[model samples]
Target chain A: MEYIIISTGFALALLGLWGILSQKNLIKIILGFTIFNTGINIVMVSIGYVRGKAAPILDVIKPSEAADKIVDPLPQALVLTAIVIGLGVTALMLVYALNLHREKNSLDINSFKDLKW
Target chain B: MIKKILIIGLLAGVGLIFFDLFNAYQGSEVLGKTGRYYAENGADEVGAANLVTAVIVTYRGLDTLGEVTILFLTAAIISFVLKFRREDFIPNRPVRITSELLDSASQVIVPVIFMVGIYIFINGHLTPGGGFQGGAVIASGVLLMIMANPNFGISHKVIAKVESISGIAFVLIGIMGIFLAGGFLDNRLLGLGNLGELFSAGVIPIIYTFIGLKVGAELSNILGTISHAQNEKN
Candidate 1:
């Protein structure tokens, strides 16, 4: 199960990288960045997965058995922060894209030659 | 053609690295040292039903503060980048009239969404959701309202006030942690109530509440700024 999730994350990440590299539309590239971000989050969560373990919540499980019964909570916490940060980064990227579009009146990456060598 | 090929080559290399890491990773049968310690002692130490919340709200709380600061900066930077004068504003484009279904449904759904957002953050100590999730949900509610009415003005004054007040409260609680409890941002600043209760984790719920309000305001500010900017065409 963990392997499947981890592999799916990798696949999505690769797909997102392809989108980022090949897409000409600024919005599409931002979409790719978001997909990539989600993929990374998934991979991080899967890394904490323990076989046949419950979630880190102690609602049903006894506190005494929590160490043995639950999956890793640390990664969950780290990924929580990562997810929020990703949202911020994605929002910033979209704002940047909006500004870029306003300046060039085009979403195509090829239209902006100011940074081209 | 060359660019496409180069891109594929780069992706393949990255994929290979991922594959290598994947192959080496044997799913652990047990928690790591830190995770084990938290899992075993977290409930007693934090008195929260959700270990993840215990970890995020208390154990690594300084990181959460940094995360909130980063989000606030992102919103600020977006608004700053998008600042335009009324004199420079282009003529407003034709606003699309939302469908009746959406218009009416949103009126009913938005309040429920807001309530759920509040519930999620309030129950952050016992549930899987937390302040960030709740804030995003609240922002989505704001987004729905904006979508229903393109010209819906979210008062900047209100958003700014909410954000600053919550932010100050968050920091103040953290300061209180130093004086009253262990270190900074300590959830134990307030006495930990009975586990699984609504108010179990001392300052976790309070901090998460503030974090939720601040995040909701920041994100709503970003959404409002961006949506308003849609009217300004060069």
Candidate 2:
């Protein structure tokens, strides 16, 4: 079931990439990037999950001796870091998008052709 | 098309070679058992049930400090991009609203959302939520207010104070860790009390609180700047 979810996420990510590549709308491209980012985060977190296991934090009320039963905390930390970085990047991108809107008066990627050969 | 195929083939070949090299190093003792050892001993030493937090705040705290610096740099860059330096400015006309009910509903919801963000940040160490999550939530609350009440601009002075104070506090906490625990960002300064407790992780919670506030302010400022810029252009 986990593998299936991950695979579907991957598929959606690929679809997002396709959207980014094919779409002319800047908003669509941004949305596509978000979709891709979400997929990657989900896949990473899923890889760290262990069936029937609680999060790595020791249960103070009910301690367990089985190490294998605890889900790895490393990926969660990494994901948290990734999510913050993603927010920063997205904020920067939105700022740039606003600038683009100012200049071109449209949210179309194709319209941003200043550097095209 | 042919070039794309060639590039894909080359990438696959390189990936395979990389995997092979990784496999060769997997069983090698030369890699050392430092990570495993740390993983085993971390919980007891740092008194943090969250091994990842232990590693981040205790074992490799300097790196985390550097990461926070990077966040600071990003915030600086954003501020530079969105700086409002003009001597004279014209405020945009207020957004026209049709429904009094919607405005009243938003006024009620905004404060509740802000409280939720505070709750998330305060209880970060004990739960799945943390500084970043809470910060973003707070920013979203600010964003909600901005959207619902266009005239209700966040006080620039308040945001500036929050951002600067949080940034300073983060650095001071790191320095305190260094002074109290023989290393920068050391988690042992706060007695390393019983694990799973709210105050157990010492500087982790403190660092995270600063991080949350800073992130929240920076994000909301970014959003505000973008919207303001759009309004000006319009």
Candidate 3:
């Protein structure tokens, strides 16, 4: 199960890379970035998965038996933080795209040649 | 054509690296030392039934503060970069009227969404959802409101007030933890209450509430800024 999820994450990450590399529109590139961020989050979560273990919540399982009952909590916590940070980063990227579009009146990456060599 | 070929070659090289990393990953049979300790003692020590919440809100709380600061900086930078005079704006484009279904549905659904968002953050200690998730949900609600009415304007003064107040309160609670408990951002400042109860987990709920409010305000501020900036297109 973990392997399957991990593989799926890798696939998504690769797909995102393809999008980033080939896309001409700034918004599409930002979408690729978000997809890449999500793929990484998924891989991190799957790494923390314990086979046949429940979620890290102790609602049903007693606290004494938590070690054997729950999956690792550290990655889940880290991923939670990552998800929030990703949201912030995505918002910032969109704002940047908006400004870029305003400046050039074009969303195509090829149109902006001010910094091109 | 050359650029496309180069891109594919680069991606193939990256894919091979990923494949090698995947091959070497041996799934762990047990939790690491830190994870094991948290799993065993997290509920008892933090009085939060959700172990992930316990880890995020207390065990590694300073990092959470840093995460919030980063979010604040993102919002600040976006606002700074997108600054424009509101009064000077004029929308020359034809206004698109919202559909009747959406217009009516948003009126009924927005309030419910806000309520659910508040509930998620308030029950952070016992549930899978927490402040960030709740804040995002609330921001979605705000987005829906804007979709329903393009003329809708979120008051900058109100959102700024809420954001700053909640952020200051979050820091204040962290400082209180230093004086009242083990160290900074300690959830035990007020003593852990009954586990699985709404009011349990010492200051976790309070801290999460502030975080939720601050995040929601900041995100709403971002959305409002972007949407208002759209008027410049006209």
Candidate 4:
């Protein structure tokens, strides 16, 4: 089950990378970035999941029992922060894309050849 | 042709990385030292029923501070980049009559979403949801309202005020932690009541509430600015 989840994450990441490398439209590239972010999050999450373990909440189990029953909380915490940061980065990228479009009247990566020395 | 080969090579590299990760990941059936320590000590120390909440709010409080600032700065940068152009400030959008059904439906939905968002943040110390998730939900409500009725807009001043106040409160709570407890963002400033109750987690829920409100305000501000910019173009 872990293998399946992890593999899916890797596949998603590769697909995103392909989208980013192949697509000329800035929007597609941004979408690729979001996909990449999701993939990384999924990998992080799946890596932390143990067999038949619960979330690391203290609501159910006693503190002593937590070590046996709970999945790793560190990865979950990191992913949570990463997810929020990813959204911010995505929003910023989209805004930059919008500004680029406004300036050049084009969304194609090839349109701005001046950047390609 | 070269692009195809390059893409394939990249895919092979990615596959190798994943394979390496898979091999390297030795699945632990039990918590490691850090996890075990938190598991054993967190409830008693942080007074939060939810351990994840304890970890985020108390254990790694400084990181959360930096995270919120990143969010705050993103909103600021977004708004700064989209500063008003006088000609476009009036929003030269063509008058498309909004349907009554859509408007009324949103009127019903927005409040419910807002309430749920508040609940998530308020119960951060007891449940799975927290400030970030709750704040995103609330921002989505604002987004729904904006979409349903183009004219139904929130002022930048209102959002800015909410954000500023909440952000100040969050920092003040952290400062209070510094003075009242062992270190910064310590949840032990107030008495740790019974673990499962609403008021049990000393200052975690409060801090999360502040975070939720601040995040919601900032996101709503960013979204509103972006949408207005879109409207200006059309």
lDDT of each: 0.91, 0.67, 0.90, 0.87
> Candidate 4 chain B TM?
0.95
Any runs in candidate 2 off by more than 4 Å, and if so which?
Answer: A60-66, B1-39, B83-88
State the lDDT of candidate 3 residue by residue for A6-64, as single tens digits: 98898889989999999999999999999988888898999899888899887888988
Q: What overall lDDT, based on C-alpha atoms, would model 1 receive against the true structure? A: 0.91
Per-prediction TM-score to the true structure, in the order listed: 0.97, 0.83, 0.97, 0.96
Best by TM-score: 1
What docking tier does model 4 reach? medium
Q: Which ten residues in a row have the lowest lDDT in candidate 4 chain B?
A: B86-95
lDDT tens digits by residue: candidate 2, A1-117: 555555655656665666566668887888778777887787666666655565666544233342444555666667766766776677677667766776789998878889999
Worst 10 residues of 2 chain B by lDDT: B23-32
Give candidate 2's error at residue B23 in angstroms: 15
Higher-ranked by DockQ: 1 or 3: 1
For candidate 4, lDDT tens digit of each residue in B1-234?
998899889878987887788778765677777877877888788888788888888899888999999999999999889776776665446658778897898999999999999999999988899999999999999999888866566798889889999989988888988888887888888888998899988888889999999999989988888887776642
DockQ, all models: 0.90, 0.28, 0.82, 0.67
As for TM-score, the candidate ahead, 2 or 3, is 3
Using TM-score, rank the candidates from best to worst. 1, 3, 4, 2
Tens-digit per-residue lDDT, B7-81, candidate 3: 999999989988997898877778888999998788778999999989998999999999999989998998898
Which model, 2 or 3, shows the larger lDDT? 3
- Cα shift from native, residue A111, model 3 (Å): 0.5
Per-prediction CA RMSD (Å): 1.2, 4.6, 1.4, 1.5
